[model samples]
Target: MSGQKACCHGPGYGTPLDAMKNGPREKLLYTVTVQPNLDEPHGDYLATVDVDPESPTYCQVIHRTFTNRTGDELHHSGWNACSSCYYIDDNAKQIPKRDKLILPSINSDFIYILDVITDPRKPTICKIIDGDVLKNHDVTAPHTTHCLADGNIMISTLGDAKGNAKGDFILFDTKNFDCVGTWTKGERKALCGYDFWYQPYFDVMVSTEWGAPRMFRRGFREEDLDDMTQYGCRLNFYKWSTHTLYQTIDLGTEGTAPLEVRFMHDPKRPEGYVGACMYSNIYYFKKKPDSDDFEAKKVIDIPAKLISVNGEKPKALNGMISDILLSLDDKYLYVNNWLHGDVRQYDITHPENPRLTGQVFLGGAICSDLKNVEVLEDKELKARPEPRYVKGRRLEAGPQMMQLSLDGKRLYISSSLYSPWDKQFYPKMIEKGGHIVQIDVDVVNGGMRLNEDFLVDFGKEPYGPTIPHEMRYPGGDCTSDIWLANDGK
Candidate 1:
C-alpha cells in the first residue's frame, strides 16, 4: 500500500517524516473554516480550506492523503458544496478550470465526508459519506465529524426541517465509512449546531448548543421571550461508549452563547481543566477524578470597553474558541481570541485556579475607541474622544484558527471569518481579505511571548482571499484532537 498510487477526492493528509521515524508522534492539528454565503443559492456553511504543518502557506484544498497505522496510503474525498464557487486566488483570478470540474451549486442540508490517500505525492479522495443516505435522515448540515481513538467516527448533524428530522449524533465504521448507530437529542427544543470536540484519551466528549432549549420552546410557542431565561450556551458531557449525557453546565444568564469548549491537561498537574468561550465570557472548568463530572470553576468576563475599528462593540465573537495550545511543559495555556482581537495566555500551573498571567493585543482590543470609524466620520463630533495610540503588535485581521508544533516551537495562524454562521456575515463583510501569519514563541523567565521576527505571510497564494479556519499536522483531525501522534520516542 505504501508503494501504491492514489487519486484525489478532497484534501489530503500528511504526516511529518520526523514523527514517523521517531515513534508515537504528536497529534496533527486541523482548523476548518466554514464558508457560507446566505445570498448564494444554497445557504449551508461548507468547509473551504485547510491549514497544516507541511505548508508554509496556510491554504490547501480538502483532497489530500495520510498514512494509516500500517503506513499505507489512504485517500480523502469530499462531497456537497452548497454555494459552488471555487475560492479566488490572491490576485483575484478564479481557478475556472477546477471550478468547472467540481460542482458549484450549494446543496441545502447536504453533508460531505472526506477520505484521503495516505501518500502525499498521489493523494486523492477515496470515498464520500453522504448524510442523506443515513437512516432516519433529516435535512443535512454538516456539523462536526471526528475519528475516535478506537477507529470509529462520530458525526453531529444539524437537523433540517425539509428532512423532517431532529439533529443527532451518528456513529460510523471508520474503515468502511458505514453508519453503525445513532444517538438522537430527542425532540428537544434547542437547535444542536455544528462541530464537537472529542477527548478520546479522557473518554469524554463535549458539544455545544448554539441556542439553549428555551429558544426552541419559544419557536414551538411553549414559552414567551419575556419568560425565556435559559437561552444561552450549553456545555454537554457524554460518556464515550453509550454517548450518554452525564453532565451539563449552563453558562450564566447574560446570553453567553457558548460556541466551543476545549480541555487541557498537564502531565505536571494532577487535575486538568476545560475552557469554554461564548458570546460573553470565557469560562473554565476543572475535572474531578472522584466524580464522573467536571465543575465550572472560573469565568473571565469580556470587558465591554473593548471596541472594534468600526467604533461599535462587536456583537459577539461568534466562532469556535478556534485554537488553544498548552505550552510544552503545560505551564502556560495560550488561546486565540477569535473575534475579540487578542491572544491570551493563562497561567494554569494550578489547574484548579487558573489565572491570566499575560496577554498580547492583536487586531485591536475588542473595546478600543479607535474601532469606531463611524464616530471618526463625524468631523464635528467631539463628545467621544479617540483612543490613544499604542505600539506593540496587532494582527491585521482576526485569526480564525491556529496551530502549534509538537515541540511547541512554531505557531501558525490563519485569518478568515466563516461569515454569517461564525462572524462578519458574508458578502456584506467581503471587503476584508484573508491571510495566514506564522509566529515563533519563546519561553523566558517562566513566561511565554510571541517572537516578532518569525512572522510569515500566506497572502501570496492563488486561492482567492482565503479564510483559514483550522490548522493541523501529520494525521490528526480537528483542533481538540491534537496530541503526540506516536509519542515522540
Candidate 2:
C-alpha cells in the first residue's frame, strides 16, 4: 500500500480513462459490489456489498434484495457496457449511457438486470428477461455474461432446448433493456459454453466449456465422469465482428471443465488464462502471429487433494479450481481452488510462465492440515469436533466466486458455486452458511494477506443461511467491465 493508490482501479474507474464520461460523473465514488445467492424455494437475489477500502464499513453488506422467481439459483454477473466510455490520455468513443448489471441464473431461464445507478446504496431490479425469453431463443440456463463493443449484453447459455450443452449466446440492449435476439447468427455451434472473453481490438472472442447443463445442474456425480457427453472439453474462438466461428480447439482430456476465461487487461495483448475445474489445470492460450489460429497450452496444474476410502486413495483429486481473475495491471493472476480450499496468486508478467507468489488454505475436503487448532466461535464458521488448521476457522465450503478491486488492493472471496453442488460439495454451507473474506494484495511485490476484520458472513443473514456466488462491483471489476470503442485516433 506504499506507492499504490488506495482507491479502486480498473480500465475506467480510478485510472485516468480515455473514454468520455456519462451519467452522474462524480469521480465514480462508492465501491458497490453485488453477488447472487443460490437458495431454493423463492430465495435468490443479488447481494450488494460496500467495498470502499477508505470507508468505515468497507467490507460490510450495505444492502441486499431478492430478484429471480422461486428456486432460481442466482450465479454470474457482469456490467452493462459502461466501461467502454473511459479513456486514458487517449480519446475513445464513449459507450451508450448505462449503469446497470446483467445478472443470469445458470439453473433458471431468467436474466435479472440490476440498476446500481439510481441509488448506489440501494440497488434495485430494473428489468428481468423472463424464462420465456430464453425459451424463445431455444436456449436454457444462462451462464457467463459479457458486454459487447456495440453495448449488447452477450450472455452464453449452458443448454439448448433439448438440454444439450451445445449452448449459444443471447444479446440484450443496454440502453432500454430489451431482448435483442440470440447472438448466434451462422450455424456456428459451440459444444458447450461456460465462460468467454472478448477483445474488440483483435475482433476476436474465445469461449470455454464446462459440460452439458443437465449433468452439472445436479452437481458433480460419478455418473458424469463415466458419461462422455456429460461434461465439455472444448474451447471455441469467434470472429467478434461477424459472430462467426473462427476455430474450435479440443483441449483433449487435460482441459476438462474449463470455467472462467480471462484475457490480459491490455486490449492489445492476445494471451489469457482459463480455469479447468474437473482436472484442476490452468490453460493459457495465445494467438498465432499473422493468423486467426490460437493455441492453448497447459501452464499450471493444481495439486490434487485426494481422500482415502477404506484405506485406499480415491480415483480423482478433488481440487476444483473454480474461479480465476487477473489484476487491472494484468501482471498478477488470482485463482481460488474451491475443493482444495486455498486461494493462490501468480505473477504472470511472462505469458508463458506464471510464478506462484502467495497461497492460503481455508480448509476443505482433506483435513489433515489441521489437528490441534482452537475453533473460532463465529456466526459463519462451524468448528468440527476434531480440529484441522491452527486458525480453527475452517471454511464450511470451498471458495466459489471471487472479485478483485480495480486497483488490485483487495480481493473478495465467496463460497457458493451452484445450488445443487453447494449442497453436494460443502453441505455445511447452508447450515453454517457461506462467507465473504476480504484479502489484501501487495500488487507491487506479489502476495496476499487475509484481512480478518473484513468478513461478511452470508450465514448470518436474516433470511437464514444463504450461499453466495459470482460477485461484481460497480464501475468496473476484474470480471464484469467491457470496452466498446478504443482510443480516439
Candidate 3:
C-alpha cells in the first residue's frame, strides 16, 4: 500500500515497517487503529497509519486488513506476552513469540490472533478461537483481554450464551492459542464485565463491569436502569499469581457502569484509576497500606452540562467517560466524554486531588443544539456547540477509543464509543463512519491542543463508513507493558 491518505482495500497492505523509523526517528513504528463496520454485516478491520510527521504520508492510513466476518463488533486488543512477567520486545515484530495482538469479539465468541510480523502491511489473522467452547462453562461475549505472567491470554466475559449477566473470565493458552479454563472464581462472580488492568508490582489485578449483554447489545434506555441486572457499580480485585478473587469494592449507585480500568505506571505505586460512564466519575484506587485489601474513591465527577433547553434535560445524561488513557510518566490523565463532546486532561501529581488543566470539545448531542460557551480557568470553552449545532448535538458524537503515545505527547482520538450506542447517539457514524483526531499534549503544563493537520476520517473511505475503536502502536503502550518484579533476574 502506498502512503496515500486513502485506505487500501483487498491486500493493498504494504511493508509493515514503523514508518517513523525514517528521518527524525521516534520509538514507535506505525499506529494500528481498529475500525469496525457497525452497520449490517460488512466486517471489521485495522487501519495502519504512518504517525511519523517526518514521513511523506504522515497521518495517512497506509494499510488496512479486514476480519472478513461481520456483526462481531470488534473491540479491545493486546499483545500475548511469551512470559507473564517479561518485558515486551523494544523493536521486535508484532508476531507470535515476539507478540501477537489478541482481539476479542463483543457479540460473538470469536477471538482473532493477528500476525503483524508475517506482513506488516497486511497483517494476517493467523489464528481464531471459537468462543463457543466457553459455552460449556456458560461463558460468552468476551470483553477485555490481558496477558498473564505465564503468557496466557486472560479475558473478561460479559455474559453467558443465553445473554444472562454473569461477569467472569476465560483464558487462552499462548502456545497453542487454545481456550483454557475460567479465570474468575465462582464465589466472587461479577455482575457484568467491561475492562481491567493488572500490576505485577503489587501482585494485584482489578476489573470493572458495565450492563448485562442484553442492555449493552442495544442503545441504552432510561427504563433499563431500573432493572438491577442491567448495570454494575463495583471494582473486583484479584491476586495476580493465583487468579484468586481478592476484595471487591462496591461504589454504590454513583458508580454506575464502571469501565476502562487503569493503574499507575510505576510498579512501586499501589494505586490506579477507573472511569464510570453512567454516573460520569473517575475513581482512584489503591492497595491499603495496612493490608493487601483495595479501596477506590471518586476523584473526578463530570456533571451533565448538555441541556437541550434552558429548563429541560437532554436526551441522554451519560457523560459517558468511554475511553481513558494515562501518560507513560503517570503525571497526567486524559479521558473522553462521548456524550458531552469533550476530552479532558488532568494533572494527577496528587492522586487524590487531580487538577483539571485542559479540555477540548468536539461534538455532543444536547450541547450542539444549544450552542453555549463555558469559561474554565480563564479560557472560554463551549460546553455545547452553539450555532453550528455546535456541541455535537446535530452530529451526536464526541471523542472516543483513546490511545496515548509512548512519550504521552500525542493522544490519538477516535469517535466510536460502542456498537449499539454509536448510531443512536452519533447517527451519522453509521453512514459516514467514525474519525481519528490527534490532540497534542503540552506535557509540562498539562494542556491540550488538537492537531489540525492530522485527521483519519473513516467516513471518507471508499468502502463506505467504518467505526474506529481501541488502537495500539507496534510497541510502547500502557496496556502492552508489564513489569515483573522478578523478571529482572
- In candidate 3, stretches whose alpha carbon ends up further than 4 angstroms from where it belongs are 1-42, 82-96, 309-316, 367-383, 386-396, 486-489
Q: Write one digit per residue (lDDT tens) for candidate 1, span 1-489.
A: 011122211121222222223323332333333332233322221233334445544344443222111101011112221011112123322221111001111123233333222433233334444435643454343445554433345566444434222335666664456667666443332334434555444556666654332243223222322332333345667665556667767655443445544554321222333334443355666567777677664445444332234545633333235445565456666666665455666676665555776555445223344333332222222344322111222344544555555555556666553433333322322333344455555544333454554333322223333244545443332242323222210
> What is the alpha-carbon lDDT for the whole of candidate 2?
0.69
> lDDT for each of the candidates?
0.41, 0.69, 0.69
Q: Candidate 3 on 123-239: residue-level lDDT in tens?
A: 678888775777777988788877764547888888877877878888888787887788875476777777887876677888898877877787778677776565788888888
**In candidate 1, how many Å is residue 347 off?**
2.0
Model 2 ranges with Cα > 4 A deviation = 1-42, 53-58, 85-95, 227-230, 309-313, 369-394, 484-489
Residue 294 lDDT in model 3?
86
TM-score-based ranking: 2, 3, 1
Query: lDDT at 35 for candidate 3?
Result: 41
Error of 1 at 476 (Å): 3.0
* Candidate 1 lDDT trough over 10 residues, lowest sum: 97-106
- Which stretches of model 1 miss by more than 4 angstroms? 1-118, 121-123, 134-136, 160-167, 184-204, 212-232, 265-276, 287-289, 306-323, 327-329, 364-371, 374-396, 421-429, 444-463, 477-489
Clashes of 3: 15
